[model samples]
Target: MASSAASVLNRLLQNASRPKKPSQPPPSPSLILHHINSNNFAAAFSALFSIPTPLSIPLYSRLLRISASTRSLVDARHLESHIISTHHPRHPPTFLLNRTIETYAACGSLRDARELFDEMPRRNGGTWNAIISAYASAGHSHDAILLFSRMNKSGSSRPNDVSFACALGSCADLLALLLARQIHCLVLKYGFAKNVILSTSVVDVYGKCGIMSDARKVFDEMRERNAVSWNVIVRRYLEMNEGEEAVILFFTMIVDGVRPLNFTVSNALVACSDVSALKEGCQIHGIAVKLGFDGDHVVENSLMEMYAKNGLLEDARKLFDDSTSRDVVSWTSIISGYALCGRFAEAEKLFDSMPERNVVSWNAMLAGYVRCLCWGKALDFIFLMAKESEEMDNVSLKLILNVCAGVSDLELGKQVHGFVFRHGFCSNIFIGNALVDMYGKCGNLRSAELWFLSMASNRDKISWNALISGYTRHGRSEEALNAFGEMQWETTPNEFTCSTALAACANIFVLRHGKQIHAHMIRNDFNMDVIIQGALVDMYCKCRSIEYAINVFEQATSKDIILWNSMIMGCAYNGRGEFGLELFEMMLKDGTKADNVTFIAILLACITEGYVDLGHRYFNLMSDEFGIIPRVEHYECMIELLGKHGFMVELEDFIERMPFEPTTPMWMRIFDCCREHSYARLGERAERWINESNPLNPVEFNVCSGPAMEPS
Candidate 1:
């Protein structure tokens, strides 16, 4: 029965083909629209638009109108099917198929666009233009340029203004200036210089490629302009960090009645923050709010970032709180603001309260902890992330590794090393650099060297800095200097490299080598770096050149807390005890809050001068007013001061009340004092301490009884 039915249909088809007059291709539009409406769009679009050579624009427009209405109903699979049905057969005209592909490209369905591109039967200028624009829009400029070359070779359809414009856009995306100029010449040959869209695209391309003069020439010649034309110049100024120029362009755009988009306001606000024009930022803020763009995420994020950068944390926090829906960036901005303000505990609390956590969130928290010297907790989070198999990105690993280096936890550091090794991240440059730092901080310079050698690539400046710093930290100053010389022979030393080597020179008292590094720093214009300057100051002081140290300290253009500490401590350590005292008092008067290290330096200065009363007063003030409890070093200072004043009885009482066990050095000082003063009663007490410190060295009574030093 089925064979009979097929025979009947074949007979009817044969008779219809033999003597049928042309009937306008059976009104393919109506049939195609029906098929498109009934969800048989693939078959309908293919049949209606399958006239091979020059595709009709009117028919293509009709099909596009229908497709545009059902855009939300289109899925990825439907787009893929359309590309397949149109390109695989020689039926669809190149222009119509290309037009349909443009829709998919605009919708960001590059995968579908590529599928159609690969299947095209007869490619032409329109087809190549469609593919090139898709690739450039999707940020695959290399692919776009490659496709344009293939299209030029085809020579089927001549390149037009759209073709050259699209190709130039690709080159701009790639930042290929040479290629863009070549395409601009092609645009001129096509006489499309008068095309407004093409001209503006050229301006945009040149502006993005940093050829601002050429972009401006093109812009000035344009008799017609649009929003995009203004944005090109505005963004150009913003890129140059010329906030004033960008503001002028924005005003011109607005006065010209070109309605500013959300992106335009966002870019201008970013420029304001770049130049730290806080007043300009606040004015732009009001404009964005009035324009109803304040609630937009991109605008809000930029505003928050602007306020944060300008040190307006309160305003940033208020903007963040005003947002009804806060994303990870919102939380990171506020938390990072706290970190910038030195409110580490508050930053930690905000980090904990965040409902969502991303790598940025973790990085902000880790940086905060590192700043607070809570490196142990920072490392804990790093390990926790590893244990949970969360994405351990290169940045997070580097941050944690730096914290590991700071605290010098060898065991925990080794565990992280094991994780890096297992995860195949050991070869990553950043991870490798951080690993060098971790091993160095753990006091395993050899291990650090091993890791350094294992890196598969040449080391960057950071890698060199880590290794040099490791050697310096381990008291291998000679080796560190050797590495520094080698580094200079191979690569240019950055400020950090010079600073790390200077720190080593300070540690080893290599005054000559340190001076050479200082010379190099000055030559490179890095003498102004506060860290490098501070390090040089410290180096000179450690080498006992207080005059040179003072010169470096005084020459600093700006001073941070570290600079103040370095100068004060250097003065205290280099026999300039009086100067150190004067600097400390000046620092206090200047409103530089004295940290624990500051107090320690000043107290040591007083101890050196035998101003026992003043030392005690500072200690009491640090404890009571500043909330700095005495640590072991502070207690040692008190003990030494008391012993120096011949107060053996009081020194004993002070040592007894210490929160930690007194080291042998602390006890030996008391014993020496007792012996010097001929205090027989205190001598007996000191002897007991020495015996207790060394159980094997038993005290023996002699005809002139005295304490033995040690066992034979």
Candidate 2:
């Protein structure tokens, strides 16, 4: 294609090398004028050379009046008077001047066009139209409109199709829809609506001005329609997000047997991506292949992005691989696909191999790393991006800062905060939210609150959720509830906020407030979420209402393992040992496998209820049946169970065989049992273990047995 264009240019330059006529005689005045006005350039060239004499030459002036093409080929700047002396010496010179200006205007030399227009011996309607169209075509709409108004003020000829088109184009460029309407009315008044070129230009103008309805009205009124007219309307609809309409219009064009152009098909396919119209997108793809436009880069890029965005990664990859000439945008689309599909390693490898990269390339890499949970790597990439002179704008900063929050990196978070302040991006809403989340995730509520208060705008649900959840996770239950109360005044809490606040409620044991929240959930129709319902059940159980917890648990429509665990643990902790055991058995019967925490609660319940036999059964079942390994707390519960039963010899033997050394509390439990049963030999052994292992007194000991302090 490059060589073809160059060859075309070479031929044009070669045609300019013809030898000039030498001492040619001039032709008859009428004959020369006829030759110049003729449309055929070769015929006019021959007639100009047939002149008989040079001294009495009147042909040059006649030639000037003939054709714009002949005058363009001439180098007669010094022979101007001879031509003028013969032709129209007595007539008004406005026609010749207008012709000269129009010639330059058509040749796209706007400066020369303007110069000729200004230096004309006289100005007229044709001259103003020429200059206005020239300015409009050059994207100098203001100059075009100014000259147009001047023509009207001078009472020159009213605008024809050519003049109206220029004026309307200026209105479109400026988005002056009102001015465009006025031009439309004037064009209608002049009965130029039948002119297909004028009508198409007006449709294009209206479409650009966002008045698609008017554009359609003009389009339907046209007696003759061209491919350009169809493309303009289709593009307008696509831009408006009316993808369905765009597709419908495209098929209508096809049904009318109008072959869809590359741009028209591209517009329709691009619209499919916006609405996720997969069927329509496929149809457009099929049409493109049939029309041989599937190979066009623009159409192919849009197809790749469309399929990628619609969760069709494999299909998108297939299209990308099939592409013959992939540009940077092509690579960006495929990389974004891999990132979105959670294939970060592949995305990163492909990004590294790209021959060249742009801003989109950097952003894609950063976003990919963050999405893959590699926050440290994301931050590293951010520094490299800055060194390469890629500006970290608000979107980039927000992505990296969110990664910081996820990783809970306080040092990196603080440095990013400073970067935000220095770069004047502190006020961006997304960046501010990310900052709040970062401090919250790092267990720094003080910093989080400070940043939250500094935000000028009202908080969104994400902001409130982050603040509330931060407090709950850090054991600041009272503050979490207070933030929840404040958030209610600003915005309604969603299920996530309610669940988080319920967690705080369980910690504080504020039964009154918890009941009120439960009532609010019922009133606001938030009782349907299984997670929130489970939270409500847990909150009720923590507040020491076993019956209410059971009621809420029973009413929950979809009970998951979390709900079952919450109920089991609630019963265990609140002294409903029999009920807790029954619930555990029911959970197993219902095929809900209890996890380690659930088994711990079950064993603790057995110890509290003096069910030593049941505790042994579960301990063995935990290891053998469920294949669950016991942690330290599980061991503690077993010791408590044995010590409560006064099984000293068995407890000692069990402790000796343990994987980890027993803590002082485990021996203390045994010591208290010895004191209760008056076993002096066991008490002496406990005392010796305490005195020799650590001279310092243990902070806590069983109340039943302990030596008194020597002095204060």
Candidate 3:
């Protein structure tokens, strides 16, 4: 046994002394990564620590990457400390430090990431990128920009593609056009333009800065383009209200053979929606199907919205029903579409059917009710929304306030105002504008002024316009004019602002102010749209400038029926019945179809001029030739014509044949005419009808009885 032990010890020493063939070096760091990737984290970590210091660097990097990806801050910190302890006094390799910084940033420990970045004895492009990206992702855009400037000044590290992309993103967030341009110059100087991501980032910066011309220029200059590059420009155009141009660019993108991403498809559909370009929308929808993106929820929702906004509710409904994955936006889009198309009942039904509802979904339904003039339903929805936990947003308040103003419901407007205060939405500029308009419309000028004063610092053109329009609506024409002058001193008035000012001038018959506004329109080269033309024509006529009204009418580039009606009514009011008839004939000659208003104006002219035959002819022709059903005013014109001409029998026959009961005002008109002609018998008949219409009010009967007067 002694001899065997001696021989074994001799053999062990002999084996140790033998120059052993170098055993295959311990499993590489890649092997350790293989274990980590397979989720054998225990074994991977054990192997990581067991490896030599030089090998451990790569192993630690792989582990840090996994930690960052999984957002395991604990493991990340542990690994970071291990790297620090293992490589202390001498700085860790730049790549390991970068990965560690990235891990910390990804874990939302930006403080740690930034501290480690600061402590790093050396940094490359990757180190700078990680920290800049960290700051940008955290919404510290200014800090990110400052760091990027430091990187540019630091001669040790040059701005690479990643660095440029991060810096450009910061500029985008900051909307720093000058800084972005400088960075763009640096990108070009550094030959980073060929990097697709860097180029895309530059384009995005320009877009966010509202420099679409530059954005397009950069995009056009790109040697290579991707889906993101196309999307950025298309979305920018949409934001700029160049929807038609956006659609054109979308088609151009398609022809360029770049495949549309999901975002691209959604943005293009928005462009189509804005322009109401149904044909182009349909073509894009077809492309989406071919690209298999039609099934994508965002694209489907956008398509639904486009169809809805274009009045293609049928197609919108079809798309809604066909969508397999319907989210809140999908339901909201369809509901809003129905509401916008004036199909309130369908919108309500669909809204009730939604399984899950958000604030946006509720707002859409409420807005629909308001738009369809279902005032009671809209108010009820507001109350219903109050009962729920879902908080009302600014859009909800704006829409409901509009409904209150439209229905002249002061009580409800006050309630909405209270809600705005309670919800702290009073500070929202849009809500402030809405409140001003609502209170003005409700005849609560005090409240309107209060809200307007409160929002003085935040007042935009819309805010000023709303106030001016409100004053005009309530017959505070002088106040509206003063407000207009104040607005001009503060901000440049838009077309709406000028148009409302013109309306104020018309209401007060201020010829001087009207002339000034007209001159301003001319100097500013404002487009003579139908609204402005109508306003000018009405203003001239109201100011006793019928020739000027006629001049304005003739200068209109494209006259809709409203403009034509305005001119006709102007002539009628000025007692130019002959000229009114001439204008009507001109309207017909120009293929401008007459509506109920047209016939009403023409009938008024006939009545004023005592053209009884012409009155009868136009009244009959209204329904027979023009398909315009005679409204109350048309009937009033007819009755006035017959009563003034002493055609009592025909007037009585017309009254009996009327479709609806004569309102109190209509009966008052008949009684006045009877008194004018001293027809006691006919007067008594009209008096009895008025009394019957208001049995409880003897005042109306008494007033009519004592109202006999001399004929004109």
Q: Which candidate comes out best when scored by lDDT?
A: 3
Q: Compared with the true structure, what per-residue lDDT tens digits does model 2 show for residues 543-576?
A: 9988899998888777788888888888887888
Note the residue pairs that clash in candidate 3. none
- Which model scores highest in TM-score? 3
Q: Model 2: which residue pairs collide?
A: 25-51, 25-53, 26-51, 61-83
What is the alpha-carbon lDDT of model 2 when measured against the actual structure?
A: 0.78
Ranking by lDDT: 3, 2, 1
TM-score, candidate number 2: 0.57
What is the alpha-carbon lDDT for the whole of candidate 1?
A: 0.77
- Tell me the deviation in Å of residue 599 in model 2: 2.7
- lDDT (C-alpha) at residue 64 in model 2: 44
Return the TM-score for each candidate structure.
0.70, 0.57, 0.83
- What's the number of clashes in each of the models? 1, 4, 0
